[model samples]
Target: MKKRFGLLLALIAALVMLVVPVGNTTHAQAADNSLEKIQKKGVLVMGTSPDYPPYEFQATVNGKSTVVGMDVQIGKKVAKDLGVKLKIKSMSFDSLLVALQTGKIDMIISGMNPTPARRKNVAFTHTYYQGGYDIVINKTDKAKYKNKDSFSGGTLGAQTGTTQYNASKSQTKNTTVKGMTSQSDLILALQSHKLDGVAMEKPSAEAYVSNNKQLAAIPSDFNMSSSATSSAIAFRKGSTSLVNKVNKTVDQIKKENLVKKDYLPAAGKYLKTNTVNTSMTHYWKAFLTGIEYTLIITVCSVFFGFIIGILLALARMAKGNFFKNLLRWIATAYVEFIRGTPMMVQVMFVYFGLGLFVNLPALTSGIIAISLNSGAYVAEYIRGGINSVNIGQTEAARSLGMSNGETMRYVVLPQALKNIWPSLGNEFITLIKDSSIVSIIGVTELIYQSNIVRSDTYRGVAPIVVIMVLYFILTFTASRILNYFERKMQHD
Candidate 1:
């Protein structure tokens, strides 16, 4: 019901934006001057979720937020050639298209393959790179199923939305095909013995199998299609001009043989294959998508949690006999339960446990799970802030004939929140970092994105390290914002 209400509110807001004259004028302005506005602003807002390697990943070069990968390098080149600064907005692959459609971004450069269903929404550039499916398995299991045709009754896993899944579904009649959201999940399942094997892109599978002693991909002799299932940049439908420019840029890059020479260096360590490494570009999209979800979970959890905490704090601080006591008890129980339990358990209860009793949308389940978990910590922060207010301030307000509400609003809260500003900032940072835990509930966050990268590239360490830096940048920004507000309040 909460989800439905939120959706309804969003729909109503969208409708209002559509019907209002102001919205009409804004839309008209967007249509007329979008390109001009971008040129004038000197920024090309490129949207991509960078969790995949050889395509995108985070790495520290000279201690900056260096988003590396083939796509990252290419995007930087595109922006540089256009004489515009690149403002890369990280989001899930699905959300990248939405950003383009909403005119929030000029173009998308994620590892998005052109599909019939997607073509209706976005225009695509020329095909850039191509590869196809391969089956991966642990070395111990390889002896049992030496060939693809032999895995008739095996438990198989594949990323939820990929061509490899279609192939896996058709190839094995008695196979239990587990549709995981990202390549990382499949890899984890396979490693943990939850799956006998996984069907994935040949490059990514090869890369993964090469890195681990227990894992290995099917032999290279196994014929996989090398058709134009290549990835391409996407723009809103009818944006032929932008598509053409991107295509030209891609041609220039490939003509330069950037893939063989600088693909790894420019894209971070994940793109560069060592003597022992194998090709694993296929897992890039899944990893990037996961990172995007992590960011979403962080933002949503913090935003909603702030409101809930504020309300709860105010309730607990209220002057009443029965009501205050009741709120105090409820708040205390909530804090203790949440702070005492493991976040992993909380996630499982919401996704799998509650799912057994009631149906829930995947995204809704993730949001509710994280929000509820984060709320407990937020409530404690609020309570601490409320309690930190000097008792003399309340007494002074009361002597001044101020109401209890006025005392809180003017005399107590403002001062209390100021003292707790650093703690609030710390909580927000913790929430952002901890949000990665939601992936267990299938909330595709940063770590989940890293899992996707590792699954696709089979090069561990590099992609994860890159993601850690990205996360640091994210948390740092939150801290800066908190500090800004703190300073402003201090001055006020």
Candidate 2:
């Protein structure tokens, strides 16, 4: 009923758009009717963050890449019992609650802990699995971090918005907690020497340690806060019927000891798989789709950046010292800031941090970050393009009785564009490749797609090699097209 009503409301809104102003939009009410909605749609839309192994991580099974884990199995059981097909949507774990609340997903099957604050926003099924947290550290520092007190004034990591993050705060003294969106990212950070230790589930820490030889779980048990930090499936607040349906499935899983029987096997399979063979060729869709999204983000963001670049270029060339100086300062400051910061930081800020001020779709936020970041650099290229135009051309236009604006509009600007076409084209190519940064926020572009493949297939170097080849094809093809355009311009 929730989704049926939502669909009906969407149709009504579409029709209303023809008559009503865009300012006043019809809002769909989200309620406890999710059970009815899934029944009607015949598909249970489950949201998860795919970076966590053994609990809804991505894996290619029988030549098809998809999310697979103990949590996923539980979700599947629920959907099957409900007589519906299961549809999995991957996103950041922190975004799952909002995704459920907004009806973007019918339920969240990620390994989400039912904290009191989270419970207020969404209903949780009964504890599906209970796992205590453990601290993972470099083997060299294992002796250094034997107890909680040893971590005082040391850097620790956890998944942002998770119980582990909160636990890291209360359980350890004077520890600086670094929170990331995904367990994979946290593990990577730990490997890079940026974090002294990370507080996460024992299973995941164990998995990392088993896979990465340099890492070790602390021998002495440092509490990850509470045994009460039990994992549960999440649904929108007031989704009582849905909650009950999920709980029923969880009861079955617990009765079966599915954690040991199912989750361990899955994690073992992921840990063991290392490369693609003739048998795995059917999973090509994951790679193909990844390339598709990368191209789309690259193309769209570059076009958006081009528009921004033009405006900034005009501002740089504006009349009067005050106006010119102000615009120049603003444009210069924007360019420098964007150039100075890592694209990953910009992506995280726009996708995660910017949400406090406004609501935006994940993809939209990513594109906006890419566009804004690209715009700054593109503006400098455009300014250089304009500057390359001979001063004699501007003077000649002025001598012909044309105004300063008219001279730039007719002669100077057009010639400037001709000179800068290749440079601008190069910018577009760069933006395409750099757009992969947005995947950190779960945009699912090429790199993110490959990540899913890696997650699912447990093939690390193979996926990286494949990604490199795919990116080269994209960038190389793009450079060729740009060269063609540049040559065509010369002939014209």
Candidate 3:
């Protein structure tokens, strides 16, 4: 027995040695063809967060909402130099890096800073623009607070993952630094007196103060290194060829001072048009597009989620042989893992992790992620519903010379679905709201579109109110439709 055990261990070790690569894994590294790939595709995709004005923000051109700012101008120049068309992909600021690393976008030109921590993960071109920080405050409190130090004992806000946010946290004494995902949200917090001031780039602060009379700007006065204050374009690491090509554009822009001469002025013109009509009515088309995408995501997720739930429910209930038990274990584990993680993390994982191999479109990735999440929850409801069915009915079907599959199909599932109709309807309604989670990946759902409207109009609250009402109407209408079906199910 000892010799047999020794032999078994040796066999396992030998198998492991054969399966794993030993050394010198350079052959595994991907080739540096980033620039060639972009040119072949004929489109240089630039990722950005469009909420930051003067750097990247939403604007309406030719009656259509569009992304425009200094970063976009730089992206266009880089693409032109490469002899390719430019495409802008907008996501949250924090998601930009993940999106680039996952090959969802070719480059990032969203006024991104080349901090040391970021440089370790991605390659950066030469600095395209040198920028500084400013603190936005309520006009009434402008005199009360002179700089970062004056915010002592009060909360100062900044966009999460930004240099200003880090500076606010490190440089201030006896101050609470609050971070939010959106600059518009931070500004809203300031107006509502939730924050003493909001820290942001100087250009963005100027744009906000010029647009809103209630706001004023002051110097941040936080010590920073040049890398913390300089903006550059980011690419996936090891893209030396792409980085070198884009650096030429960056160098020419700096030599000619094109940012100050042309780009900033062009971005300023867009900011001017943004405030001309702050009313939600003028952006009706934007809201309509939002509703359309929202419905598309919710409907697709529900349909796929329900199908997946049914399969998982049946799999979890399986009991017979070794293979059947394995299926049950897998189904159970999947449901638990999905329920344990946040939907946002799951969405990002699906978009970035699964994205390593397949180049899924943002909308497609959103639906797939949301559907997988909803399925895990829906499985529980289905399992409970299936268990709630009387055992005697299943026994009766079995005794009628029917197989287990047939019994489940003819007797158990129909009754189970009927019993869980209301729960299923509730899940459907919940998904309508939860579908907004995909907005982080730039799906252009209602929340994303509303963010654009807020950035474009610079009236943060109005866009929120519009989306709130629109969501209520969507969920309310869905609830009524579900009720009608539930009534029909009961009557039958």
Candidate 4:
């Protein structure tokens, strides 16, 4: 029985190794395979940051909140030209390059610039649109920031990992540049007076000014470096065939002036007015759908976390140094590694980083990332609870002829669970909140929905306020339910 049980545990641990990126650097991409995979999959995944309006943003289509904009339509056309279905993954601007490198997406159409530094890492298609960088400021502050010199010693905002960020730091002397995650966030910072000005493409800056009277873009001397002016699609390095095909499409779009003549007008028509309640009412379905995904991810992640926590605790408590040490190292390394790293990094690594190794869906990848993260903290709670139980209880079980496994199963865990219930409850609540980070991978959770609502609505704070309330309600109800269970356990 002991030998059989040991064999079973070893097999389970080996299986766990398959999903944990134990030392993976992304799946290897070779010549021909990159394009071949897409043809075989029959779907081309295009990544973009939906927060960049006019280029890519959200709008209502047939009574549903759909992602639509210049790049989205162009992505559709490119996918059609390649004779494949199109799938859009909306993510943070910074993660787009790494996502392509890891094979999480086939291409990126997020108004990216093909700067020389980027060219070394990834290939870019022909320029799809032409524009220049400009500064946006509150109308009242226009005179204060007319030229590059005007921003001297003032704080400015730019999207992180973009050419604008570098320009903000180098173009003007002594200006404190704050790097934000999205264009929406940078705009909010500018409005809230956290930033005196923001650097962006002329069109993006103009789009914001058109929607909000208080905001205005400087007339386009477009002071950015030449490399930042033209926008293009991105692909993994050496993806020759895919890049060639996409460049052909970009050439056609430019020849026909599709962006100015067709895409811009179509995007304009889909724009939603910026009314707080009206936006909420129109986008209620999207919010509800987001809530549903959030709940599902939370429940599933907690369930798996508990399983891993209990197993790690048992491995730590077990005897037999050789086999035990192996399990202990695995468990301890996982706990410390996950707990030490940021959840955002873990989720991206799982979605795209792990995509190099496996083909998990967005929802499944999110659950796995959160579960591993939760397990680390959960293990400590479990280990502490088990240690707190009187040692005499285990001796008594042994005297009654219980095997070590049986004693742990029938005696130790039940008491430990009682002590750890509150800790477990706290972990669950935190998971509900931490799950928001997975939105960076385009999971469509509450935070992602809030972004979409704000994208087209043009009113930012109100939609997020609604999501804040929903998150509060979710955590509050979960706390009450957990308290009920904890009380019942105590009474029994």
TM-score of every candidate: 0.55, 0.70, 0.93, 0.90
- Give me the displacement of residue 340 in model 1, in angstroms: 23
**Model 4: lDDT of residue 175:** 79
- Across 206-320, the per-residue lDDT of candidate 2 in tens digits comes to 7767766688987425454342447787786666777787788789888989878876786667555533342335457887888888888888899899899888877866767
Candidate 4 lDDT over residue span 1-492, tens digit each: 000112222333344445546333243343346667787899999998887777888777667767888889999989988889999888877667667766778898888887877787788888888777778899999877786568878898877777767766776788798877778777878888999988887777767888788998885343655557788888877778778877888899999999999998777666533323355777888899899999999999999999988888777666677988898888888788888988876776677656767878889999999998898888999999999999999999999999988988899989999999999999999999998988877899999888888776777688878999999999999999999999999999
* Order of candidate numbers by lDDT, starting with the best: 3, 4, 2, 1
User: Model 3: which ten-residue window has the lowest total lDDT?
Assistant: 1-10
In model 3, pairs of residues that clash are none
lDDT per residue for candidate 1 within 65-147, as digits (tens), equals 34567777778877887678998765443345544655557887766677666676667777666655567898888778665
Score residue 335 of candidate 2 by CA lDDT.
79
| Leading candidate by lDDT | 3
Candidate 2: worst-modelled 10 consecutive residues by lDDT:
1-10
Better of 1 and 3 by lDDT: 3
Best by TM-score: 3
lDDT against the true structure, each candidate: 0.64, 0.73, 0.86, 0.80
Off by over 4 Å in 2: 1-31, 138-145, 150-155, 174-177, 191-196, 211-215, 219-228, 261-267, 274-289, 304-413, 453-492
RMSD of each: 11.8, 8.1, 8.2, 7.9
Over the full model, what C-alpha lDDT does candidate 2 score relative to the true structure? 0.73
Which candidate order results from sorting by TM-score in descending order? 3, 4, 2, 1
